[model samples]
Target chain A: MADDSTSNTPRDHGDKTIEFSGLVCPVPLQDYPNIILGHGGGGKLSADLVQHVFLPAFQNDHLAVLGDSAVFQLAGVQLAGQRLAMSTDSYVVRPLFFPGGSIGDLVVNGTVNDLAMSGATPLYLTAAFILEEGFPIAQLKRIADAMGAAARRAGVAIISGDTKVVERGHGDGCYINTAGVGIVPDGIDIAPNHTRPGDVVILSGTLGDHGMAIMSVREGLEFDAEIRSDSAPLADMVAGIIQVCPDVHTLRDPTRGGLSASLNEIAAASGCGIVIDETRLPIHPTVQSACEILGFDPLLVANEGKLVCMVPAESADAVLNAIRSDKHGSGAAIIGRVVADHPGVVVAKTAIGASRVVVAPIGEQLPRIC
Target chain B: MADDSTSNTPRDHGDKTIEFSGLVCPVPLQDYPNIILGHGGGGKLSADLVQHVFLPAFQNDHLAVLGDSAVFQLAGVQLAGQRLAMSTDSYVVRPLFFPGGSIGDLVVNGTVNDLAMSGATPLYLTAAFILEEGFPIAQLKRIADAMGAAARRAGVAIISGDTKVVERGHGDGCYINTAGVGIVPDGIDIAPNHTRPGDVVILSGTLGDHGMAIMSVREGLEFDAEIRSDSAPLADMVAGIIQVCPDVHTLRDPTRGGLSASLNEIAAASGCGIVIDETRLPIHPTVQSACEILGFDPLLVANEGKLVCMVPAESADAVLNAIRSDKHGSGAAIIGRVVADHPGVVVAKTAIGASRVVVAPIGEQLPRIC
Candidate 1:
C-alpha cells in the first residue's frame, strides 16, 4: 500500500495533473530533509506530512473527507440516525499566555470551532495535558481556570481528562490536547466536498489578528494600537448561520495555515476553483500594519475565531445577515466565490484588476503560533 | 477554591481518621518538594495530585464519578437513550516497544479496556501524536501498524487524528494521546459508587505480569522462560461477563498502580471496606519470583491486561465462569470480598489467618510501566 502518488508529483497545481515515471523516489525522506516545527503549523508542509505519512497509514473513509471534524452515523442499539462528529487537536503555542488569549482558551476554542465547522452543536470535550516537571502549580491553575471559563462560555462540558508529567527538560511548560464530540443536527450536511461552482464564499470576520498578536508578544514588537488575538468560540455564530440557511456547502476556520491553506484545501477536495476579490477581504488596520512590518502575508497568517463558508448564491444575503448579527461576525463579508474552471486552483483578484494564484505556504510563517 | 486536603496527612492508614488543628499548608508544595515521575504513576501520589489539583480546577458533575470512563446520556434528535462513554489517556512510556506490546497497542487496549470497565463497547478513537524531530519514520510506521492491527482486533475504528512535531530535545521519540467514545448498553449501571459491602471482588487474571515484564527488559534481566507483558484487550471478556451477569458493580484494569491502588480507590469512592484472601490472589510463579527478587509487592505492580471486578457473591461463580471462558481471563479467581466493618479500608487475610492492612503506595514502584 505504498501509494506513491505524492512521490510522482511533488507539487499540485489546481486541476492540472503532472506525472513523472522511471523515478521510484520522486520525493524521498531526504527531500523532506527533516521535519521542522513548521510541519506541525498546519500549512502546506503539515498537509504534505499528513498526506504522505498519516493518510496512507490510517486509511479510512471517515478520515478521507479531511474535514476539520470527522462526522459519521453511530447507529445506537435502541435508536438509529445518531449523527456524531469527533475531532482532536493538540496545542503547542509558545508563550502560554498572549495579549488577548492563552493556549488554554485556544485549545478549547480550536476544537470547538472544528466541530462547529461541521454544522454541529459542539457538546462535550475531553482534555489531556502533558506538563513538564517543575512547572509552577500557580501557572497550571491559571490555565485550567481559563479553560474552564472558555468551556462554560462555549456551552460545552469538560467531561474527562488525563494529566501526564514528563521529566524537567524533556517537555516545554505544557502541551494541551482537546478532543471533542458534537452532535450534527439532522438534515445539515456541510463538508468541503459539497462545494459547487456557483457557491458564494463568505468569511466571518478579519484575518491575521491571531497570528500577529502572538508574534507581537513573542518578538517584542510594540505598536501604538495593539492587535489582539481573534480567539473566540464560533459555535453560536455557526448555529446562527445554519439557522438562517442550512444548505451551506462548507465551513472552515482559518487556523494555522490561514485562509490560503484553507481555501486551497476546499478547492482541492471539491475539485473546483475558488476566486476571491482582494478588496473585499477584511483586515484590521493594525493587523495590516503588523503583517507588512513583519513581512508576512495576511492570507497565510493564522486566525482562531473566524470561519470561511461557501453557500448557495440564493441564500448568500440571508446567511451574511445572520452572521453579521453576531458580535464576533460584525465585519463579515463575501470575499470569494466558487468557479468551475481551473478545478483546484484559488485565484485572487488584486486591487489593480490583475488576478494572482494563491499558493499555500510550504511551511509555517510563524511556528507555535497556533 | 483552595482545597489543600492532601497536605494535612501525608499518609493514610486503613480505617483511621487523624486530624490536624489548622495547618494551612497541610502537605505544602515543599513537603514533597519537586514533582517526580511517580506523581503520574496512578498511585496514591497520582490520586492526591488529581484530588488536590485537577478536581478543584475542572470541577463538574461528570468527573466526580471517578470511573475509568465517564458514562453520560446524549439525547439524539431522531431517537433517545443514546448512552455514551468517553475517556482520554496520554502514553509516555520510556521505551516505545517492549516484550508483549509497544506503546501503540498499549494506548489502544488501555483506552478500550477503560471504556469496557464502564460496560461500554468502544466504537471510535481519536489519536493525537507529539513526535520529536529526527524520530525515524520507520519506527512511527511500526507503531502505527501495531495500533491499526490492535484497533482492528478490538473491533474499534481510528476515526480522526492530529500530529505535532516538537524540537528534538524538547520531547521523547513520541507521545500519544488517545480519546475514545463508546456506547453503553441499556440497563448497565456500572460505576464505582454502585459497589456494595457484600460485593465479591474477582481478579481477572494473575497480577504483576506486565510491570515485571517491562522491568525485566528495562533492567536486562533474563529467565529460562521469558516473562511477557499481559497487555491484551478485555472488551470481549467484559462483554461476555456482562451477558451472564449484568449486575456487576465495578470493573477496573489495574494499570500503573496495580491492585492496591485500584482497590483503595474503589473503597474510598464507594465508602466501604475490602478484604482479600492472600491464598486466593492469583499470581504467576515467574511474576511472583520476579517481584520477590526485585523487592516489589505484586499488588502494587502494574498489569496492562488484567481486570478487577466487584460482583455479588451469588453471581460471582457465573461471572468467573464467563471470564474464564475468555483466553485472557483463563486464570480468573475470586480473590476478595467487600466488608462492612470499616469503611474505606482494604485488609488482606494471610495464610496464617491473620489480617494486615493493605496501604496504597505513596508513589509508583515502577514508573511509566503502562
Candidate 2:
C-alpha cells in the first residue's frame, strides 16, 4: 500500500488535496527484476509496466482509448443525453456461500447494481472465473445452479463468459470477475457530479446489513438477532424508480466503504455538502447490535444490496414510493438532504442531537482474505 | 495474482481432458464465511476454491476455460473460415519500477500478444487499476506518462479505465487488471488444437528476460552483465506475420507459467506431440546466468515480449522470413516440430539426441509473490 506520494501531486487533485492520505501508501515503488510484483501492485509501477510493455505492442485506434467508461452511440441516442450505460463488477466475496447469498447471486447482483447506478437498463452480463488446481466437482454444480437462478431473478441474460484454472495455490478457491455491459436509458445522464445541494438523499434500505453479515461470518461472531446479508440485485428496483420518475440527479451503491464513503464521494464530486439525520437511517436491530459489539461504525461497513440516490427535491417522494414497491427496497427511507455549507463533506446529525463528520474509510476490515 | 484461470477454452479442443487426480486440493468452493490464502496457494485448496467458487460463478465454458487460458470470441468479425480472438491479463507484478518495463508497458503489450497469438488484430483494450492507500503522486505521474508513451508507440488508445483506492496494507502498492478485445483475421484459426505432426514450432526472440528481470530486481541480485526485462510489445511482429501469411497456425506468449508450461499446454490441447530442440531455444546470456545462480529453469521463466508460434508445414519458411523482418522477431528460430507420437505431450530434443517428455507445468515455480 505504498503508492501514495506518487498520486497526490499538484497536477491533478491539487497539491493541497487531503484525499487518500490514510488509505494511500507512502512507499517508493521498488523496481526489481526485469519485472517485480509492484508492477502488478496497482501502484505507479503497475501503471508504468502497462504503459511501457503493453501499449506499444498492438497500438491501434481502439486500444488507444481511455475513459472512466467508454461512451458510444448504442441506440439512436448520442453520448451526452440519451446514452445507454453498461458496466461490470466481479464479486469475490471471500465465502463462496454467504449467510444469505452465494457467489452466484453476488455476481449477477453486483454488476446489475453497477449498471443501475449508471442509470442503465441492466440487460446482459458476462461472468468469468479462474478456478484453482483441485476444485471439487459437486460444489461447482451447485454454484452453476445458483448462477442460473440468480440471473433468472434479475431478468438478465448470463449471455457469455470465460473460465480458466490456475495450478492449485495459484488461485484462490475461486475468483469471479464479471464484465457486464448494459445500455443506459435514453435522455438520462447520471454521473457522480450530478448531485446538487438541493437534492434529497434517499437510501433504499437499512445500511451495513451485507457488510456486517459477512463480517460476522468471517469473524465467527453472532448477535441476538441473526444478521443475514442483504445481497440482492438492484436493477429491477432501479427500473421501477425510473418508471415513476426520470429526473433523478444521481445514483450509487454504497459497497466497499458503505454509505459514508459513498456519500462523501458524491459530495466531493458534485462540490456539495450532504447532511444526514441519524434518526432517519434505517439500521436493522441485528446489524446495530453487531456494530456496537464489534467497535466498527456501520457507516464504514460494506453492503451488497443497497443503493443511495440523490434526487431532485421535486421527485423525492415519488422515487421513494417507487423504490419501496420492490421487495428488495422494502426498507426504503429518506435519510438526508444535500446541503451547501460543507462542500465535499458528509455531516450527520447524531441521534443525541450532536453533529459528526464521517470521512471515507481508511482501510477494509476484510481484506482479500475479497 | 489470483484469477489466473482464464477462460481459454474453445469448442474445438474437446479431446484434451485435464486429469487432476494428483493435484493437491482443487476448487472445493464450500459455503465459507471467509476464504483463506490457501485458495490462491495453487494446490489442493486452490483447485477446490476455483472449482467450487469460480467454476459455478462461470460454469466451465470449456476445459481451456477450465485450464490455464481462455480462448474467447472477438467482436465485429464474421469472416469465412475464421474467428476473432481476445484475451486479457492482470499485471500485479510487485516493485512498480522494473529492470526494463513498467506496469504501463506490460498491460498494453500483454493484451496485444494475446490477440496476436489468436492470429487476431489486437485492436481495443481497457485497463483498470485498484490503487492502495498512500501511493506516491510523483510515481503515478511517471506511470501515466509512461502509459501515454507506450500507447503512442503501440499506436493504440488506452481506451478506458477505472481506478479504485483501497486502504493501505489491504492492497499491495497497486493492482492493474486489463481486458482486451481483438479481431481475428479471416482464414486464420490458430489455437493449440491446430497443431499436428510435421508442424513447425518457432521461437521468437529470447526467453526468460522478463521473468529473470523480475526475479533479480525483486531479490536484489545483480548480474555482471545487467539484465533488463524482455517486456516489449509484440503486436507489430504479429501483424507482420499475419500480413505475410494469414495461414500462420498459432501465436502464444509464454508468460506467468513460462514457456515450459505454455508448450505443454499447446501439446495437450492439440492432442499432438511437440519436439523442441532445447539447444536452439533462445536465452539471453545474462538471463541464463541469473537463472543458473537462482536455480530456476529457463523454460519455466516468463517472457513478456516474445511468443511461441507453431506454423503450418507449408508456411514455415515464409513465416520465419516474415518474423525476422521485425525487431522483436528478428531472432526468431525454428525450435522444433510437431509429431504423432507422445500425443498431448511436448518433447524437447536434447543436444546428445536424448528426448525428454515435457508435460504442462503442474504449478508455478515463481509464486504469486507475480
Candidate 3:
C-alpha cells in the first residue's frame, strides 16, 4: 500500500530520469495527529501536504507535474476579450487586524498582486469567507470597509463572493480564501522560464517592514519602532512596467519568505544563477536592526508591498527609473542580475568581497502573517 | 465612522448595488473561546464572522460582492485544447470515513461535474486544504489515497495547491476546496441558455442516495436498509455523450438541494422554464422511504453521483443510451423538457395533474454536507 502511494505521487518536473522525492518535509502529516503549523511553514511539511493531499485530488495531465506555475498551450482557441487572470489566497494571520493594513486590504491586494504577477491587467476579484461563530459584527464591518477602499485604490471591481460560517470550535474567528480572474493582455510573453542570462533584477522599495511589523506586534517586542506594514497595491506600477516591457521575464511579490524565497524560486525555475551585491540590497535601517536583534536574516523576512522584477539588462535602468518614480516604489533598486552557469544558485556578495550562498528558505520566518 | 462601517459591510445579492466596508475582526486573540461547530453553519452569524474577520483580511474587488457564482468573460485566451469552462467548490462533509467513499473522492468528482455542466471537458484542477490539528494521520492517508484513485478515474490532474493547519479547536477535521479548468469544444455550445422548448431532460441515476447516506451516519440513525454515497466522476460520461452529440444543451449534477437547485439555477441563468414530471424523477425505493421518514424532500436533497442533462428531442435516445452504457450511469432516465415561456420557473407535474413550484433554497437545508 505504501509503495503504491509513493509510486502515485505527482512528479515535480516532466523528466522521468530526474525525480525529486529526496526533499522531505520534517512534519509528515502521514505520521502526525493532524496538521501542524509546520504544514504551512513551507518546509518539508508543506511539501508533503502538497504531495499527499492536493496533487492526487487534481491529477491532470497538465498539473500532474508541478512547475513554478501551470502552463497550458493557448494554441488556436478563441481567447479574446475575456482573458482572465484568476488567483485565490487564504489568509490566517495571528491577529485579524494589523498595523498599516488589516485583513481586508491584505485579501484584496494579495489577489490583485497575483494577477499583476501573471502580467494580467487585474480587473476583478472574488472573496470567499468561512467565519466562526460569535465573531463581532463591528469587526466584520471594518473589514468590508477596508476592502472597498482598497478596491477603489487598485482600480479593480469587487465583483462576486461567498460567505459561510463554520461552528466556533471548527474554525478561528475566520479564514478568508479569495479567487481572482484577470485578463492576460495580448502579445505578452511573461513567464518564469522567460528569465535568461543578462536579465537585471529589480527590488521595489525596502523589505521586511510587513513581516517585522507583524512579528513585533504579535511578540510584544518594542523597538523605538515606528515601523509599519508596507502593504499597498502595485497594480499600477506593474501595469506601467508591463506596458514598457510586456515580455519581462518574471514578476513576483516577495511576500511570505521575503526576497530569499522569491529569488530562489526564480533561480530554480530558470535553471540559472543570480548575483547580488549586499550594498545594493535595500533594507530600512530599523528593519535591518530588528532582523539582527532577532537573529533572522532580513532576506528571509516577509514583505507585503514589494515586488521583484527581472528584465533585460539594457532596460534595467529604464525600468528602475520608472519604478522609482512611483510613490509605492520610490526606493526601487537594481539588486541583481541573472547568469547562465552555476544554475540554481542565489549568491549575494558581501561588502568585504565575499560571496555567500543564500539558499532557499526551509520554512516560515514569521507565522500567519498572510 | 458608523456610516463608513455600514457602507463597508459585505452586501448580499439581495442588494445588487454593493459598496464593501467592514473592519478587521475586533475580537481579542487571547480571549478566543475554543472553536465550535456553529462557525461552519451557513447562517447569519457565520456571515458576520466572515465579514468581520476573513473578508477584511483578504478583500479584493471580486470578493466583495457575494453571488451564487461569479460570472467571468472567457475573452480570447484559449485554454487546454479548446475554449474553456471553469469552476470551484469546497467539500466539508462530516465523517472523513464514510460509506462508499470519503471527502477526497467527493471533492474530485464534484468539481469535475461542475465543469462538465457547461459542456466543458475536464482538464486541470487546483486543490487547497485546511487541516485541523490532531486529525488522525491514518484517516488522512485514507482520504488522500481515495482522492488519487478518483482523479485517476476522472483523467485529471491537480496542478496547483495550498495547505494550512489551523490551531486546534479552530478548524474541523479537514475541508477540501477544488477549482477545475476544462476545455469546451467549439461548435458545442452548452449552457443554461442552450435549453429551448422541447429540449429533453435526462437524469443520470438514483436520487437522494448521497444525501441520505451522509445524513444517516451524521444522525447515527441506522436502518435495515443499506445506503452508500453514490460518489463517482462524470468526466468520462460527459465526454462520451458530447462525442455522440455536440449539441448536448445542458448538464448538471443534482447536488446540494438536488434536482431542485440544479434546475432552478439553469432556469434562472438561461431565463427558461422546466417541467419535470415527479413520477419520471428516479428515486430509489429505499431512498424514498428514508426521505419520507426523515421528512426530507428528495428534490431539495443532494446527490453526489447524479446528473440532470438536457438534449435535443431528436437525440434524446442517443443521449440516454450513451449515458446508460457507462457503469456509473446505468440507471439513466429521460426525466423532462425545457419550455420557452414561464421562464425562471421549475415546476413538477404530479400524477394528479397538480403542479408545484421549485423555489431556490430558503437557507441552510443541510450544512457542511458539501
Candidate 4:
C-alpha cells in the first residue's frame, strides 16, 4: 500500500512515450498486444517492461540508476567503511546447454558480471534451482559440475543455495536463480547515470555470439564454423580497467537486448547522446554470415561475455589497453563517444558516412538467448 | 574441477547407509526409484537429497555448518568491522494465496527468518520472479504488493530484482526466489553446531497451522474453524530473545520438514540429544483435527513465522519471557531440552509417558506448503 502510486504525469495513454510512471491501466503497448517472446529478449521490450512496469512499482534510489547491479553504501555495518554491491538474475535460457556453456555457469557468470559492472569484486553467490521432476540426474550433475568449475574460475563461492521441484510437465528441466554480493572499493563510484558528454564508449569484444549460439542449438541451425556462446566471468577484465582507470564512469554488459539496448539505457539514464561507428563494431566472419542468413542484426544480438564502458576521454586509452590485457577482451575496440546533441538518443555512423538512429529492437530478436 | 571429490569413506559399495561419500551408484532409495512428491517434502527424502546430492557437490565451510543461514565475517570490507549473514530461498507454493499469507510474503519472511536464525538483523533482500506467460497482471500486482508490505514489515529493503517469463504451462503462475543479507552484531555467533547439552529448546507458537491452512484450501477440506497460516516476520522476535539471552545456542524455524527435521538437523550438527515433551507441544485444535482427518503428522507439518530457540537453562526463562512479549510469539513454550545421552537423536516423551524416536520425515506430507 505504501508503494502503490498512480503516475500524475499526463500522457496519451495510447501514445508510445517512454512512460515511467502510471497505474497498470493495461495501456496496450501500441505494438505489443500481449507479452511476446521478445518482451523477455532483453531488447527494447525488456527495457520498456523495466521502465514502465518494474520501476513504477519499485522506484527506489538504488534502482533509479538502472545499472546491472545496485550499488549502495551500508553505513556503520562494516569496519572498513566499504560500500557494497548486490545483484540478482534468473537464467531461463532454453536448450540448457549449447556450444560453449550451460545454464549452470551462465547463472554464476551472469550475476558475477552484473557485480563487475558496478566495479565490485564478487565474493559470494546464492543459487536457487527450480527443477522439474523427471529431469535426469546425469544432467543435473553436469550442471552442478559446470557451476562449481565456473565459481572456482571466478574466485567466488557458491555459499548458499535452494532447490524446488515442480511437477514434471510444469517446468522445463531447470531454471536457476543466482544472487551475488560484492565489495566496492571506497574510491570507485561507477553507474550509468555518471556518464558525461565527453566520455568514450568501448566494446569489450564481439557481439551476437551468445544469442546465435542459443538460437542455433535450439533451432538446429548449423553453420560451417561453430559459433560458441561467449559466456565468461568479466570480473577480472573489469578489475583490469579499474586498476588503471578507477574513475571510469559506466560499465554494462550488453546482454539480452544486444549492444543497442545497453547503449540506449546509458543514454537515457545519463541524458546524453551516444554516437557509435558501425565500421568499428566487431563481428566474427562466421557470426556476420549467420546473422545475415537468419535475418538478425549483429548490433541487436545478445552477448554474454562482452561489456561496454563509458570512460573519460583521457582515460580511454589506458582503459582500453587494460581491457585488452585480459584474455576475454582481445576484441576490444572504441565503438563510440558521448556527444552533447540529441540527448537520450543513440546514433550509429554508417560505413558509407551517413548517420542513423540505432533504436533498440522493440523486443528480443531471439527468445531464450540468455 | 577444484571442488570435485569422491567420497573417501569406505562402504560396501552396495549397502544403503545413505553414504555421504562415494560413487553416484544409483542406490535406489528402497521404494523411490525416482523423485517423488515426497522427495521435495522437507522430510527424510529432502534431507537425503541435500546430503547425498547438494552437500557433496557444494561442500564448503559455510554450508558445512548447516545453519538456516550462512554467517561469515567479511574482514576489512566493512568500516565498523562487522560480520554479515546471507541466505536464499525459493517459494513455489501452489494456489498462490492461502488464508493468512501468499508466496510473496513467504519469500520475504523465509529469508528474513533465515538471517534471523543466525542472530543477524536483516537489512536487505533481492527478489527474482519467474512468471508464466498469460498470468493475469492483476495477480502479479497483488503478489508484488504483498511482497512490498512484507519487506516493509520486516524492516528490510527489496534492493534489487529480476524478472523472467516462461511460456505458459512451462511454469506455475509464478515462482519467487529471494536472497537476503543482514548485519550480525559483534559477539553474536549462533549456529546449529552451537547447540550444547543442557540447552533448553523453546517453541515460539502453534505448529501445523501454515501447512494445514494451505492443505485445507487446496483440498477443499472444511473445518469447524479456519486454519490461518502462522506467517509473520520473526526477525523482531528473534532480536527480542537475543537481546535478553545473547547466548541463545541455536534458532530454527520448523519449515519444510517441520519441528522434527529442524531438531534432527540441530542434533546431528551439534552431536547432541534432544528430549521434547509431547504434552508441551502447542497445536491448534482445528489444525490437529485437520491433520488427523488428512492422515498427516503434526510433528512433520510446516510453520512459517514460528521459530525454535535453544538457550542455556539459566537464561531459558528470560528468553521465554522475551519471546512471549512479541506478538508473533505469544504462545511461546519450552518444549524440549538438550541431553548428553543419545547424541544425534531426538526423543519425544509421549503424553502416555512412553518415549519415541522423533524422526524427520523423508519428504513433506503436503507438497508446496511453503
| Ranking of all predicted structures according to lDDT, beginning with the best and ending with the worst | 1, 4, 3, 2
**TM-score (0 to 1) for chain A, all models?**
0.91, 0.81, 0.86, 0.91
lDDT (Cα, tens digit) per residue for candidate 2, span A86-106: 454434466777688777777
Q: lDDT tens string, model 1, B1-370? A: 1443323322333444422111121232222434566667787667766676667767788887878888887754544555889999888886789888999889899999999999999999988888877666667778888888889888888888888888778888789999999989878889887789899999999999889999988888888778888889899999998999999999999887889999988888888889999999899898888888889999999899999999998999999999999999999999989988678888999999999888776665886676
Q: Give lDDT tens digits, candidate 1, residues A154-173.
A: 99988888877888788887
Give the share of true interchain contacts found in each model: 0.52, 0.06, 0.40, 0.46
- Could you say which candidate leads in TM-score? 4
Write model 3 residue lDDT over B1-370, tens digit each, in one string.
3444324233333323211121122322221222234334333234445465545654543344232233344534444335555566767787776777889898788878877776777766666677775565557767777877887788776655656677677788787777666666766666666677888999998898888888888878777877788988887888889988888887778777678877876776677888999888888887888888888888878888888888889999998999999888998998888998678778889979999777555335666667
Ranking by TM-score: 4, 1, 3, 2
- DockQ of candidate model 2: 0.08
**TM values, all candidates:** 0.92, 0.70, 0.77, 0.92
For model 3, the DockQ equals 0.25
Pairs with steric clashes in candidate 1: B7-B26, B7-B27, B8-B26
Q: Pick the candidate with the highest lDDT.
A: 1
lDDT of 2 by residue, B221-289 (tens): 977887887777777888888777776766678876678867776775677778899999988899889
- DockQ, every prediction: 0.46, 0.08, 0.25, 0.41
**Alpha carbon deviation, residue B45, candidate 4 (Å):** 2.6
Q: Candidate 4's residue-wise lDDT over A1-370, tens digit each? A: 2322222122345544553222122333423323445556666656666666566665577766667888877655534557789999988889998999999879989999999999999998888888887665557778888888898899888888877778878888788899999988878999988999999999999888998888878778888899999999999999999999999999999988889889988888898989999999999988898888888889888888999999999999999999999999999999999998888888899999999888766765776666
